[model samples]
Target: MSSKREEELLECPICWDSFNIVENVPYILWCGHTLCKTCILSLRWAEVKLPTLPVQLPLFVSCPWCQLLSFRLVWKGNLRFPRKNFFLLWLVESANGNRVRYCPSSSCDHNFVLPSNRSTVSRNGSSSSSEYLHETPRSSPRDRQRTNHSLLGGWRILTLLMNLTAKFPVVIIFMLIVLYVIPASAAILVLYLLITFLFALPSILVLYFSYPILDWLVREIIA
Candidate 1:
């Protein structure tokens, strides 16, 4: 049997629902009180006034337990809420028999992995069931998987570029030649040809006309 303190830790004060990995993910406020994501969304949604126009305006979310007000902005018809409490989430997962493992590499897309086996006591001496309300969850596995794959692909591309730049000094020079040097050289050559043609044309016309005018004047003077 779980103690009263353990039960309190596992459940949200507002909805009285046990924190889970899905819908009731734990979120901590600036005032140090923890609430489930559903309750937080509910509070924010309650304060939303009917939009006079299509644009949804910002609203203040007040904590039910402390009445502490938090200013939140409406982004694309969704309220931007506080960050999830990962420590509390780990505790919840741990209490529910889910073992959390972190990636060894710092550059990993997913920070931690949760695998469920059997119920166990967490470091904080809390044990709970995995059942949770099917309220609107903040995140889904498919979303997370998609995000991880996108991030991993981006990282792979970045890593490949970095490796190419580092391993072969010629690659950097080749890129510079392709992206900057070649274009600049072509522009400079074109400008040089244009300037030479402009200057030479004016000088040749001036000389051609001057010779005839000078000879005519001299012939007139001689005659």
Candidate 2:
């Protein structure tokens, strides 16, 4: 929808009431809260430590209305202005000098100013400032996929390394022992070795990969 029509059709999920949205600015989440592209981009810029990958972006975001964590809303089409597209799309700073995410609805003109120290806004009916909530839960589909891919990739790499190390001594001994065997039986010995190596390779690779991951899990539990 065009920015003008989008503004008209958009309703606050929390309130279920129509609200005006500003075009060519921040994108509103499903929960009716507005967030600047910079805000979402900034989250992608930060690194979070994980067990598998040494570090990764903490892409999880919070809902503006219900104060729940949510996946980011991607802005596309004419709503995304061209001049500002490079900066916003790549997490570049806005020329206007405001680094924080602002309310995209030019009509509503609500700005999401995240204060230092607090991570989320409260939806509770309490009027007290103390009642305002922060620290929304962490949940992002991209983050989940990234974590899973990292784990699988790391295991594969580690297994490759382990197999190279573990089989070296055995391979050397097998070669040395074969050299001392009678020449008539040498062909039979070579065939036996080849069959043994082929049969054991898959199992060895599996054990190599599984052990370290298992060890890491155990250590995490103990810690």
Who wins the TM-score comparison? Answer: 1
Clashes, model 1 = 0
Q: Clash number for every model?
A: 0, 4
Give candidate 1's error at residue 117 in angstroms.
28
Off by over 4 Å in 2: 1-130, 175-223
Score residue 46 of candidate 2 by CA lDDT. Answer: 32
lDDT of 1 by residue, 88-135 (tens): 676576545422232224433344354355466889999855533222
Model 1 segments more than 4 A misplaced: 44-57, 73-79, 98-223
Could you tell me the C-alpha RMSD of candidate 2 in Å? Answer: 30.3
TM-score of 2: 0.22
Best by lDDT: 1
